[model samples]
Target: MRTLVIGDIHGAYLPLMQALDRARISPLDTLIFLGDYVDGWSQSPEVIEYLINLRSSYNCIFLRGNHDDLCLNWLNTQQHNSLWLKNGGQSTIEAYKRITQPTLQHHQSFLETLPSYHLDSENRLFVHAGFTNLNGVNFEYFPEMLYWDRTLWEMAMALNPRMSPKDPAYPKRLLIYNEIFIGHTPTTRMGITIPMNAANVWNIDTGAAYKGPVTVMNVETKEFWQSDDAYTFYPNENGRN
Candidate 1:
């Protein structure tokens, strides 16, 4: 069975569906989502509902994202923060208005249950943003770092290609996993719209919240598929731009 790692959706539901279809996903396959599934576009409610239903037939693992945590807080308390509202949360709030109360509760439950990270038997780690602990994720002192930190990716990006794992200066976080997969920060920031690899870490977020496409990659084969540009599907909206 193939393990497929999907990037952030950011409420571009149509693009997400297109990418999954292009990948020819099967019920037998495992789907690992890097989170930030809501916000940015007009389909936040739909995206959450679809993912909830998808679990019935597919082997799926969901990781929590910082935005997701913020969204859950809003769902539970109906409180809105200026920071979240300005950064795509307003769009999600608008989309959720159409959802029934029961469905909202279900979505809230789903968000609340999401884990911060997932470590597979093969020692591959999947997280939304990253973890900073020298001893690895389990030893991370700040739990929020799992979904909000960028240091891990930053370190990976700055790592010398020639650095050996045995080198004392090598990052212990990167050394803990056979491969690490993350989203949250867009590869588009690095001026690309595809998955990026630095050291052993793979970043799958291709900036679906803006101009890039939603990406789906097979962890083992490293073969990937992408949808059309996310903004193209929502031409009327300024999706997190």
Candidate 2:
């Protein structure tokens, strides 16, 4: 069975479905989704609902993202960071408001149940962001960092491009996992709009949150599928940034 890992969705329901279709996902496949399932677009509720159903038919692993945490905080405390509203949280708020109370609760409960990261039998690590100080073979100690650290990716980027993955100075975290997959840090911010690889880590967040494409990769084959530019489908709104 193929193993597919999706990038950050950011509430683009149609694009998420498109990427899934392009990837040719099957019932037998293992699907691991990087987070930020809400925010950016008007379909956050729909996206969550879709995932809820998807889990019943396939092996679905959903990881928590910073945006997901922000959504949860707003749901629990009835408050959120001001920047959250500006960064696509407004759309999520409006989407939930449009749904019935029980439906909203379903979404909130789903968000709360999401794990910070997932480790597979092959020892591949899948996270919304990356880990900072992970204990080898037992990586969940720094659970918060798994969903919030950018340094993990930054450290890999800091290495000289010429250095091998076996280089002595390689970040310990990257060396621990057979391979790592992450989202949260969109590739577009770096002026490129595609999945990027540094050492053994892969950044698949191709920036669907900011009008870029939604992408999914086949973890084993390293093949991937990408949706159309997200903005073209929703021409009337501006995504995050």
Highest-lDDT candidate: 1
User: In model 1, what lDDT does residue 194 have?
Assistant: 96
Best by TM-score: 1
lDDT of 2 by residue, 134-225 (tens): 56535456677777889878887777788766777656777788898999899998987789998788999999998789998999889999
Q: Relative to the unseen true structure, what is the C-alpha lDDT of residue 76 in candidate 1, on a scale of 0 to 100?
A: 85
The alpha-carbon lDDT assigned to residue 32 of candidate 2 equals: 93
Q: Tell me how far the alpha carbon of residue 193 in candidate 2 is from the true structure, in angstroms, after superposition.
A: 1.7
Instruction: Provide the lowest-lDDT 10-residue window in model 2.
Output: 133-142
lDDT of 1 by residue, 1-241 (tens): 8999999999999999999999999999999999999989999999999999999999999999988999999998998889999999999999988899999999999999999999999999999999988898999899999999999999999999999999998888888899999999999998999999999999999999999999999999999999999999998999999
lDDT (CA) per prediction: 0.95, 0.88
TM-scores for all candidates: the values are: 0.99, 0.95
